[model samples]
Target: MRKNLFHNLALTLSLASSSFLASYPTRSNAEGIMSSSPITVVVAEFINESDANWWKEKYKSSFKNMLTNALSNTGNFTILEEDEEAIDRMTKKRSLGIIPGFGGSKKEDDSLQAKYIIKGYLSEYTENEISESTQVDFGAFGGGRMKQMFGKMGMNASPGGTQKSIKEVDLTFNVVVINPRTKVRAFTRTIQGSAKEEFLSEDVDMGFVKSQKKVENKFPIKRAVMQAMEESGKYLNCVLYLQDDCIDEMDAKEAARQAGNDAMDLF
Candidate 1:
């Protein structure tokens, strides 16, 4: 009865799951942040040097979105360059002396605006993938007749073999907070994160050769990038306006990581 139940469960799960084609972002061990009053800033395009060719062509916009979302989580800064046309109109109006509030709604004071800019450079990203597959020619669990033969031949059987794809990942990135008004680099640092996972399959059909098609989840790069972004907010304060309350790279990174954890449920 239990065997039948297990089989039904396996079949049900398989039917419900989709093929591993993409990976979504999760909170990196590094944390995230929240701003005090929405400090205004312009976010420059992040320079990508991570050697990920596919991501460069297709997912660049997603990377930008991740940054925008992460920065928004920090209560301190409000993004200004998000709407280029609005900023351009404001600039043109100032030059024409048409003033935003006097002619428009006096409530639309343009003076309380973006105060800083944020920039990021993806300096280093390395995904070293190694796959090992062992053929299972014996019983599904490899413990029936196959076990007896291996044991008599002085070989250890059932080496804790798993029908799961194992993967490891490591990532690094650097970011800078700039005060456009002062033309100063307020703060900059490189942050890193890494993770490994084994995707276990309950279906006995997931033996050896079946595992090859599951490479996409082996090294989840996009997820890694998202995690790095979450914790990057820690140092913005020291660079933006938290001068004396500033933290060193290690402290800032830790703060960012913890802050990310605190903010996870909001999304």
Candidate 2:
């Protein structure tokens, strides 16, 4: 009886050791390979020109705010705040450190040392014209003795009693992304749109109406900017080998175990 018991214990120990070794290799530590470092991104001040004039400080400030908001929405990288003092210091350092044939190294001017930097220019133009149209209509009157009445609706009236006017505007945006250190452009894309307005009132002059129309046209600009950023973010993530939360690790392990069991015909 004692010999039989000893043989059974040895067999159990051997089987357990073999199972552990087969399931997990000695170097299979998943934690060490996962990265938790956050990437930094910087936005340079945008320059805008309209017709022959550049926007003043106020408009430039507004544009910067818009750009910052768009970038933050991407949720892919940390955006660095612009520090004028730090930027000046870095620029001076770069100028002093430049070597011959090095092309005046200005990489240090990019304060963020970001994986990517985005810069762009925007230009907008708008125009409006006054025009007139003539139309014919038919109506009947039945409240007077052989009385005839004729009237015309104003230019604002449509066939459906709804007033609509057509206004148009042009928008153009150009965006470029570059690697700060190498100065190599990673991406460059431009998008433009011509938008037509459906509502304009004669009570408001063409200038006021067209101004409103231009505001409405900004919708397309916002959409284009978002699309460009999304594409850029995809490229950045690819370069970094970014891992997003697609599935839980535990769930994946359970799936693998089930698959292995099915393959081995061991339900």
Candidate 3:
């Protein structure tokens, strides 16, 4: 009788579990209810239309890869690399029977379908350097009492003190989000990043030989572009996920940027 009672209890629990699972057929766990699979997106190669003379075509792929990494960090989309030439080659191979298909199907039916496409264009990229030289004159007639004391000792000279160079880099990208089904550009915006670095060097002047070698300031182009791509990813995530808080914050930042620009325009 004890064994029978245990069997009956097991059967009852099984039936209850089955009923609960049937009622929620789409999910088997609580976590499944909170999140869904990431949406698939294709990121196209970035185009460089900027005024920078050093921009190369191969850098477009690098920019696309950076953007891909940025979007992947958001954990919202399954990013796919878009390559038209590779796709064309694959298609030709498949037609020539070099690539096999499942179930003898001639066409690729289980291919990846993207819900959205991201396009980027480098609209503006510039690097500017400003350098200033400082010197001290110790001429007796031209300078102060301190200069007169130094001049009396035969030290009448204009010695170069320091040279300061400030280099600034600005990068801007125009990003567009397109709906694959509707073929419409759903969102278009510009993302920008700027970086500046200051360098100081002493100008040494020996009596016989003068040597002033100016070291090139390594502009942080990758840093600026990566930051811009990160912002683009977050903005895309906000729009794609319909996150109100992120959207509000982005809007507020844009408004503040515009206000600051307007304020600068007064000068």
Candidate 4:
């Protein structure tokens, strides 16, 4: 009876472990073999259509990596490693530098075949900077008596206010998911993100020249790109798993964003 009881307890623990693990999806191994259901996806090299000279081809590849990482973080998709050399050669072979078949090759083995090929292109990018300075002269406000009192307190009494500088960056990009076998577009989305940074420094205008301290490496553009990609990842997660609640949340957020944009345009 003791031996039977121990066997029963072991069986119960084994079943409990299986039940707990069953709630989570099985991940693919390095060979790209999924033990269970997981959508396999590949991120193609992104295209840079922006007119900015600093937006180089390497940056496009970097964006592709960002999207790949975003999708991989969802835990519902099997993200495949793309062949950069093959994609670059294919892009160069084409006249417009656009890869045909969206970077999917027929020679790819069945084990590594991706069901979805994610593509992206940057359409618009803009960065604007503005600086404003306020002239403050106590002498102009009051008279010589007030200016003399402030001067005795170690104040220059010239333009001694603050200089403020604002930098804003806007980025717009499109993501498309295509079925490799059918060569048809499965989903397409346009994502836009904007970021702003401000710098305030003590300024003194000596009437001939002005000096102000400025900050460095604010990276507003990088923040904008990261924000857009975060949204893109959530959207892809909803699409792949058919999560209705996530879809509704994304729609509501997008509607609110559009409304905000309209309100801004009215100004």
Measured against the true structure, the TM-scores of the candidates, in listed sequence, are 0.52, 0.44, 0.68, 0.64
**Candidates sorted by TM-score, best first:** 3, 4, 1, 2
Prediction-by-prediction clash tally: 17, 0, 0, 0
Candidate 4 error regions (>4 Å): 1-36, 84-107, 110-112, 136-161, 205-212, 255-267
| Cα lDDT tens digits for candidate 2, 1-267 | 999999999999999999988888355345323345556666666667556143466654455566666556656467776644544443344445543235434544345355556666665544443434333223322543212232222221212122344554555556566665456687664434344445432322222222112223322334444443444344344343344442244246447745764896854
Q: Is candidate 3 or candidate 4 better by TM-score?
A: 3
Candidate 1 residue lDDT tens string, 126-209: 665455555444434554877677657655444433355657676777787655445567667777666766655432232232
Q: Could you give candidate 4's per-residue lDDT for residues 95-189 as a string of tens digits?
A: 23334355445533422446677888898888899999776787765658766766676556675777788899988888888765556688887
lDDT (Cα, tens digit) per residue for candidate 3, span 2-49: 999999999999999999978875634533432367877778888888
For model 2, name the residue pairs that clash: none
Model 4: residue 73 alpha-carbon error in angstroms = 1.4
Candidate 4, residue 177: CA error in Å? 0.3
TM-score of 2: 0.44
The CA lDDT of each predicted structure is 0.58, 0.49, 0.73, 0.73
Task: List the pairs of residues colliding in candidate 4.
Answer: none
TM-score-better candidate, 1 vs 2: 1
lDDT of 3: 0.73
